[model samples]
Target: MLDLNYILSSDYYKKELERIDRDNSVEQGLYFIIQSLLRSTIEEKYWVTDISTRSKKHIGFSKSVPDLTILEDGKTLFNPIAVAEIKYFPWSKKEYLTNNERQVKSYLKQVDKVIYTNGIEWIFLYGKGGSLERKESICLGNDRNTPESYYECINKKKLLSQIHWKNESDFKVSWDDLICKLGAFLK
Candidate 1:
């Protein structure tokens, strides 16, 4: 189990959120959450500041800031211990679809797990082929219109653990739970 308080209250995360341009609210929120999770948990062994630069030679293009890039230990040179990418969103929509094959392939080539999210939802794309395997939602100000019990549903690990994104159904986790999980992971 991860700690859930420190992450939600971290000064670094708060500052980052404040610094982010409001125009990219969804990206800012998603970055804050993922950064909090990585900083609080995952004891990062090594990280690359500009992943786009590192990926340029292989992908033939560069990105402005990929949100976050992390690497874990590996048993063999050909395999990555853990790798992920997080994309924030204010809501769920097909318009945000990421079909950049070159970029996706670059990520898959470098890491074992690739994760993406909007502030409200999280999608995990795993394996070398980048399969969408799991997803979760966060209960936040935008979700205020939803019933309170919906948040409770996310807190129940049993319910969350059973969710699989492969079915193509949206996975919902409350913003409160997102904060809690991030807090736990951050600590």
Candidate 2:
């Protein structure tokens, strides 16, 4: 299982959150955070990278630059395993979620799997036979309006303790489950 306390409380994580709070390179900060998480958990054969430049050719995704892309064997865009769309804190706001979900669903046209997250809530979706299905929705914690609130949440261990599966109201989610699910998805 991944070490939630260490990962969440690390100096790097704290710095990234601070950068985000300052609104300095928000996308890059989010990318770094998510990249570290993916790199730490994913298999060796999988490469977690950012392909957010319009100049780069993502084949099927011409107009949109996916926040993060997973390539099998570090081969390139030709062998994409998954794509992640990241947002900032309070990304669960209805308007943001709705628009982001629509974008994620569009990615399903070419990629088999897509993840939409706000550094807290992870929505996993998979493409079927010309259709998209929401595989899971995992919430690491309840919404924190500000970055300081995040510090409080982690300090109090509320982030880990408040875990729950979005779809299954009664089901409690654990760090192991989060790591397992995300690792399995990437693999």
The TM-score values for the models, in the order shown, are 0.46, 0.69
The lDDT values for all models are 0.42, 0.63
Candidate 1 wrongly placed segments (more than 4 Å): 1-33, 44-50, 53-55, 58-67, 73-80, 86-92, 98-102, 130-187
How would you encode candidate 2's per-residue C-alpha lDDT over 1-187 as one tens digit per residue? 8645313433354445555544442445677777777777788788887877645364557446687888888476756788888876555456664666557555776588988876666778888533676667776554444445545433442222222223333223444566678788965
**Candidate 1 lDDT by residue in tens digits, 1-187:** 9755524443344334333323233344445455555555455454322243344444322332244655433433233344445543223355444454455555655554554554334444555544444444343322222223534433433311121122112222343355555433312
Instruction: Specify the poorest-scoring 10-residue window by lDDT in model 2.
Output: 157-166
- TM-score, candidate 2, is 0.69
Cα lDDT, model 1, residue 39: 55
C-alpha-based local distance difference test score of model 1: 0.42
Clashes of 2: 0
TM-score computed on alpha carbons, candidate 1: 0.46
